[model samples]
Target: MGSAREALLDAAYEAIVSGDWAGARMADLAARAGVSRQTLYNEFGNRDQLAAALALREAERFRALTGQAAREAEGDAGAATAAAVTAALTAALDNPLIKATLTDDTSGLLPYLTTRSAAIMDVFREDSVAIFVERWPDLALRPDVTAEVGWICETAFRLVISHLIVATEPVETTSRHIAEVVRRLMRDLTTT
Candidate 1:
């Protein structure tokens, strides 16, 4: 049942990404996933829940990308972290599914992109804490602060990326400035 629920959500999302906003309709989603309309309602509650699920799933992908960036920060933590952060920001800006997700005019996709998907934000923060701790164990006095730092870092990253991606701002113009700010923030706060 869980697998079917996920399959329905995946199908709904695929339709959405391919410019089939109408397919996000509960009946269409059910048909696409070979499920009954009652099943969708029973499992996911409503269309909005389905959309939120899809958003969360996409957020997981972003988390995976960040995890890759963190793993790359293995030994030489500072330089590697700076590079990873820049790369993560770039990926968030360039993510195609995110672009399409934001393009949905009906479901208020932009707010969902930031607000409802906040759960995944926590996932990234926790994951980054582990990665950063592995790289810079002595940086924090209490050990748990890495998650706090990561949350700030990701929030700052989202601010810049949201502006650039949604507003089509010049990435080159803002990248260096944002990079410096993030660097200083991490250096100042993370050091005990």
Candidate 2:
């Protein structure tokens, strides 16, 4: 059994999934979670807060999936990086919220996730860095190299995100390109 906050988040996610962010009303979310609007307000403060919470929760979920992909690749750094990128790309392609977030029109949630998401982006990058450092400790090289690797990994993430947003080519092609980049990065790091 989760807390009211988690339950409310779940309800909010379901509402957002079933409909759209704009359509997910506070009353509906409250009713879905068996809570009152006042309780929802008290828990999340406002709709913007609720949206932020939702985005954070989803980011955590995506990071977990990416981390699992890295872990599943065992100790092979290149494999781990490629696996993580593949998982992220696949998830982005499959998830509606991600698709909506990258799209230009509707949802009104894209800016919350992209342009206005410095804090969330920081968290996302940190999480990815942790995953990379865990799987490929070489990424933790001398003097803040971990930060460098983290930024590189985040760049790959952004590239994949861009591919999803642009929808210019097949996901497989973008995934292959990212995997190659990760492979090259791993090679360069290990060689240096």
Candidate 3:
């Protein structure tokens, strides 16, 4: 099994995914984790910290999957970008906690993704930029190219996140469209 902290995090995830983020009391989460409320507080400090930890954990999970997609596509940045976007979009759609966090107004989880995104985005951008660097090592289309691949990766990531939150179109369609855009950009850069 997992450690006590891991178990607590798992229980918190379950509670949040079950549509009880607002109603899931700390004592209740503690009970579900088979820990005392004092233990929960000692482990997570407070509700905001617990939520932050949860969000970071989820983000890390998505990043790892996306990184795997990029790695599998190997030497093919376009395909890798597409694969990563599709993977993230697909996973997000299947995750109830993510759906509720994005669409549910009462969960109070949206701010962690929106208003408090800078810290998360910084970490995400660093890791994602590394993925792009690994995918396209000689992308020196211009003298001032300056991490163009990173820009594309971050932009695609933002588009996917926006699509997840606003849902302007079907996830499949949006992912395909993102892939096409990334492919076209990569093509243009390689040609010049």
Candidate 4:
């Protein structure tokens, strides 16, 4: 079932990247995945559901990459934050789905990354807070500080998303600026 689901998602991804999502029939996708149409509907329920699932899967991929970047710079909070932002922005720049959505989203898929992005935002915020708490466990000792950490995480994540949508500067400059802002914010939060 898992393999079938993955294959279906892979097929969906290809269709979306090719600007054929609006015309991609479930039967076609099912055939592309070498599965029956019933199996596709059983796995994802409907076309909209399948689109949401694909968006969610991509969000998880971004979360994983960002988390790994943070972990790699475990000892330095600023460096970790910077690395995470860099990874996200870099990935977004290279991601075909993102490019497709940003350029010409005929599949009505922009909502998954914009107005309807609460779930995606939650994924990034939760993972980022976990990373912060891991690095500075002292944050766990204070409930208020922990909440602030979540806010900081959301802010940083939103900044990266903004850069992904409309780039006014290079990834390096934006990432460094966000990192500096996070460092200042953290200093204020931790000192008091």
Candidate 5:
């Protein structure tokens, strides 16, 4: 990427992580990255596009991390999947950029997710399914395993929302629920 592009992303990311999303206004971003607002727009299109891009970038980073963990987990799909869910939840809660995006009322990520824009959240679903399928394959899954996987991902994402956006519970407490989802799913697959 060009320096300007890198700078914009970096500045946007920093502003989010530092609780300065507002300070990251377009003019502020342009100034911080040594570009004009027009240049920033030219590079990233607009603020909404910038937000989406940054959010996707963070998602990519998360997927890469989970993918590595999933590979390390092969042959032990259940154990690996459980661990991956735990790791993903923990990392997402602790991730400044993620927290900023999900919890930041001003930015509108939560509404977008809660609404119909699966386009944004689908990355998580696709990445999760891909990682699980890569390690376990359809043959390994019980007849009901696919449904279980879907439920697990949906519930886990909701927990993240509840914990971060609504402040309904502590993160550590919420992440443990992931274990239950995994347990039931994996047990079904492994048993009959």
Candidate 6:
């Protein structure tokens, strides 16, 4: 990404966080980014595209954080799972854009994180499965187990999204429970 594009995205995020996405004009965002409105349009095509790009960028950041947490957990798959979930939930709690979108329905940015999140979900699932296979190479040797691993990754990602939208427990408690369930599931699959 060029500096101009980065600036535009930063400005868009700030605008959405401070107010509503629907109320944010292209010209205003461009001015905030220190670029022309035409430049913003050239980079993003339109507001919807810009919004999608911003949402994807944020998702990627979360993905990177979770991946890093998993990698830093040494050789313990359960510990890696726990660390990844904790990192995601903790980051979501502090993300102003997430808070803004969840609280303000009129933001027009909710779909990118919720109902229309297929792209984000797909990337997360793929990355998660890769992480699992890398940590537990035996899973990749069995087709059935690999499929189960994908399902588990999808389930874990959905659980994280659910917690982000509606929290029932503390981050630590939720993450620990998820890790325990995942560990049991993996154990059963491996032992079978």
Candidate ranking (TM-score, best to worst)? 4, 6, 3, 2, 1, 5
Error of 6 at 58 (Å): 0.7
In candidate 4, how many Å is residue 105 off? Answer: 1.9
After TM-score superposition, what is the CA distance of residue 2 in candidate 2 from its true location, in Å? 5.4
- Which of the numbered candidates is closest to the native, going by highest lDDT? 4
Model 4 residue 41 CA deviation (Å) reads 1.4
Clashing pairs in 4: none
Q: Tens-digit lDDT track for model 4 on 32-137?
A: 8999999999999998889888899999999999999998885456788999989989999999999988887686668887888888999999999899888888
lDDT per residue as tens, model 2, 46-164: 88788788888887887789878877876555567667767877888789777656552545567665576666677667876777777666667664777677667777767765665
lDDT of 1 at 36: 91
Q: Tally clashing residue pairs in candidate 1.
A: 0
Clashing pairs in 5: none
Residue 53's lDDT in candidate 6: 86
- List model 3 lDDT by residue over 43-156, tens digit each: 899888888888888888988888788778754566777778788888988988798787667666788777876656666667766765555555543434436655766677
What C-alpha lDDT do the candidate models reach, one value each? Answer: 0.66, 0.72, 0.75, 0.88, 0.66, 0.86
**Which has the better lDDT: candidate 1, or candidate 4?**
4
Q: Residue 16: error of model 6 in Å?
A: 0.9
Residue-wise lDDT of candidate 5 within 1-192, one digit each (tens)?
Answer: 488887898888877777777646798988888888998999888887777777667667876776576567645544565466556667876787767767677654555446633554566666666666666686235546666666665665555555555655554455556546665656656455
lDDT winner between 2 and 5, please give it.
Answer: 2
lDDT value for model 3: 0.75
TM-score of 5: 0.71
Per-residue lDDT for 24-115 in model 1, tens only? 57788788899899998998897777777777777677767756865775444445445555665677667656767666665445566566
lDDT of 3 at 54: 81
> Which RMSD values do the candidates have, in order?
3.2, 2.8, 3.1, 1.5, 3.8, 1.9
**How well does candidate 4 score on lDDT at residue 64?**
97
